[model samples]
Target: MKITKLTKGISLKRPLEGGNEEQLQVVRQVLADVRAQGDAAVRAYTEKWDGFTLQELRVSTEEIEQGAKSLDPQLYADLKEAAHNIRFYHEQQKRSGYRVQLANGSWLGQRITPLDAVGLYVPGGTAAYPSSVLMNVIPALVAGVKRIVLTSPAGRDGQLPTGVLAAAHILGITEIYKIGGAQAIAALAYGTESIVPVDKITGPGNIFVALAKREVFGEVAIDMIAGPSEIAILADDTAFADEVAADLLSQAEHDALACAILVTTSERLAEEVAQEVEKQVAALPREKVARASIAHFGAIYIADTMADAVEAINSLAPEHLEIMTEQAEQVAEQIRHAGAIFVGRYSSEPVGDYFAGTNHVLPTNSTARFASGLNVDDFVKKTSMVYYSEQTWANHAPKIARLARMEGLEGHARAVESRGWRKGE
Candidate 1:
């Protein structure tokens, strides 16, 4: 990681994708086949890929009840606590439509409506993430979505992750399927004999799943086309160098492709954090993956001033941002964009990732400029409206007619004129 002169602006790195044209073509074929054959195609793919024979794609209430009961009592309690916090975090973002009446007597307002159903794709590769199940479903539930369907790949024994089942049970979501990957996305997008189609899809998965969602986006709404997880820390002399290094290493531990960087104005802090990073990287269980990520895309920059540091931070617009600096709040205010901001020394990025209540599912790859973190707003839609009283119409008919006619839209003008106010009758 080089601390070079901050002259050239940060260049965009193409975040890695699921696969090349060959793999995408396969995904397209699978989606097409599933769309054509429905349940049989899905089951066949399940057997061939996941190695589990799923006679019934839908998970039953008995299974969920047994799975939840089988979990260690403490684990169930924790998932419940996390679910409550996640629900509370998203609850604040819920919005409602309102009707407004003008002085003249016409009423108009915007209406907010929740989608009927959403398919949440929970990835089961490597390990199941019940946290993801909580993050994706709670928002839609808080938004009052009527139906929340979930799909995840099963193990060789054809079992859903116990933690995932426990979390869903806590959330009161009974609809889940033993499916995963692009195939599951396909089934949800196109509908099958067992898997019901949904209005929207949201979750994180491997490249194949990401690309599958990307391909199906037009047919069904998608939360985001996510890339690898990333985190950036901006620090000053007041910051704890070791803590910064640890936080960066946390995201790096996620995968070899994950990115973690530090940008600061303090040369001493930068060097110390660099050394701490080396010291900590060796001890991590995921050290190899962290090392590769750090070696490839990770960097530490020593900016000439805090403003320069801020400039670099905004340029990255990382998925998770930590401000561990003197006047951290001031730095936070200067930050123009980020998926989520961890404001002080005590608030590490992982806290939000797991327990701190804010959403860990967020826009990656400088998407913060135009995107937002996952919230209740993601699950709802708003439609705008307006109305005017008869008196109000008569009061402004001439101007309306003049503008309509001026635009060469006589029909629009006549529509107003036919009201009988234009001729003052």
Candidate 2:
């Protein structure tokens, strides 16, 4: 990694989806086939892609309990603790229906209702992310969603990672499915004979899964068209170079395209962090992936001042931002964009990723400018409530009719006038 002098403007690298065209086409064909043929299509794709024929798609209670028990007791306890913390934090975000009275005696409010069912996609195979399981499921559980269905790829042995199952068992999520990739997304969006369609799907996956989500969006709601994971650390002289390097590398190791940036007021800190990154990355298990990411997307910008650094942070709108400065909270207050903000030097990025109770499934690839982290709100729907009093209707119908007439919608005007309302009457 190299430290560069900050110019008037700086932009993050945007990589193209070069060879993903074929994967995208595959996703579309699978989605269409699944929508048409249902379970047979889903099973066929599972066999073709995952390389395992499925006699049973759903994981049974016995499997979940056995997996949970098989885990090291200490890890199981840690998962239990993490789940409790996640539930507590999300419970604070739960909302209730509200009604507001108006001068005209009309009532207006919003009724918050949990979606009937939701599908959570957890990636399996070599990546056993039980933490992701907790992050995705806890919010839906807090929002009072009735049926939370989980799907992940099974191993060559036709089994989900025990760690994932342990987390699911801890959360009491029973409807687990042994499928993954674009096919699992299709099964969630459109019902199969074995797998029922869900109202919404939430989780993160590879490009194929992402493109699948994009295709099935209108058919069933999706969380977001997520890209690669990324993070931006806004540090000053008070920040530690080694810790900063480690935190940045944490996100960089996620994938080859994952981005890690550091914006700082001190050129010395920038240089030190860059050196520290090289030194630390050499010792990582996923050093090859991190090296490629750093060589491609990682950077250090020496901003003129903290204000300039904040401007760059906002411009980038990174998924995870760490404010490690003298006044971390004050700096965070000026941040108008970012999926999640980690305040203070003690609040490393991974704390929020795992045990800190904050969600790790966040917007990536600058999508944080308009999107947010997965939370209780994603699992629920808001239906606007409107009730017009007789006097209120009489008072406003003529105005409404005129507005409708201005738009040449006479049927709309007539509908408004049908209540014995006419202009100046």
Candidate 3:
């Protein structure tokens, strides 16, 4: 980790990886094939990419139960507990329709409706993420979404990971599919013979999956174009160098492109954390990935003051931010642009990632400037409703017609005036 002095106009933005033309072309072709050939194309792509012949696209209830049962009792219990925590938190975000009565005997309101169905893509080549199952599904369920479909690539043994199955089972999600990559995205966006199209899609995946989501965005709603994981720690001399280094590596090990940054007012702490990160990276299981991330994107910045450090963090707009200073909560209050804020040493980034009941699906890149983490709102639609009584329309028709005419829309003005009010009457 290299150390630098915080300066004005410094940006921590990583170059977003929009898939190259070759990848995009592949994704486009897959999407078209799936739309045309339906189940055949899905099966062909699953065999080519996942190396498994699909006996069935949808996983059977028996298989789901068996896979879930295969998990160790303790692990299954822990997953259920995590699911409970996530459900409890997202329950607060559930919404209901609202209407406001007006003085003119008319009403304006919003109708909240859950999407009919949603697709959740779980990545499944090298790792199993049961936590993602909980994070994505619980919010949609809380929002009263009835149909939820889950898709993941099967392993060489032609089976989904037991932990992933167990988590979905805990959530009572039985609509599971054994397919992945761009093809799975295509199947979700456009209905195949075996799969029904969904109103929205959510979750994280590789470059191909990301590109597929981008390609089919307007056809169906998508959660976000999530980038790699990131963590930016705002620490001072009061923070522990070892703990700070550990938190940074938690995100660094996620991908070679993952970013871990330390912004500190104490130069000594900066030096110690940089050294500590190097020492810790050596011991990680994903050391190669962590080393590459640290070498490329990780850094320690020495800020002249705490205010300068906070300003730098806001500019970065990190996916995950941790404050471990003398008054971590107070420092966190000044932050305005993080996807999720973890205050104090105890609130490490992974706590929110797993058991803290906060959704781990967060906006990446600098999108935290405008985007938000997944919640109940993402799975539902808010439709604005308006009702005008005849008397109310008569009272305001002239002004409405005048406003419409100001925009040079003769048809709009005529539509408002066609209610049979004579001129000057």
lDDT of each: 0.87, 0.90, 0.93
Error of 1 at 322 (Å): 0.6
Candidate 3: residue 157 lDDT (0-100): 73
lDDT of 2: 0.90
Model 3 clashes, total count = 0
- Give the lDDT of residue 143 in candidate 2: 89
Candidates ranked, most accurate by lDDT first: 3, 2, 1
Per-candidate TM equals 0.94, 0.96, 0.98
Error of 1 at 82 (Å): 1.6
> Tens-digit lDDT track for model 2 on 1-425?
87888776778553333237788788889998988998788788888878889889999999999999999999999999999999899999999999999867899999999999999999887789999899999999888889999999998888998899999999889999998988899999988989889999999988888899888889999998778888899999999999999999999999999989999998888989999999999999999999988989899999998898899999999989999999799999999989999999889999998898999999877788899999999999999999999789888999999999999999999997897634445
Model 1, residue 188: distance off in Å is 1.5
Alpha-carbon deviation at 344 in model 3, angstroms? 0.5
Instruction: Name the lDDT value of residue 299 in candidate 1.
Output: 85
Expressed as tens digits, the lDDT of each residue in 341-365 for candidate 1 is 9999999997898777788889987
RMSD of each: 2.2, 2.0, 1.5
How accurate locally is residue 167 in candidate 1, as Cα lDDT from 0 to 100?
87
Q: Give the clashing pairs for model 2.
A: none
Worst window of 10 by summed lDDT in candidate 1: 6-15
Number of the top candidate by TM-score? Answer: 3
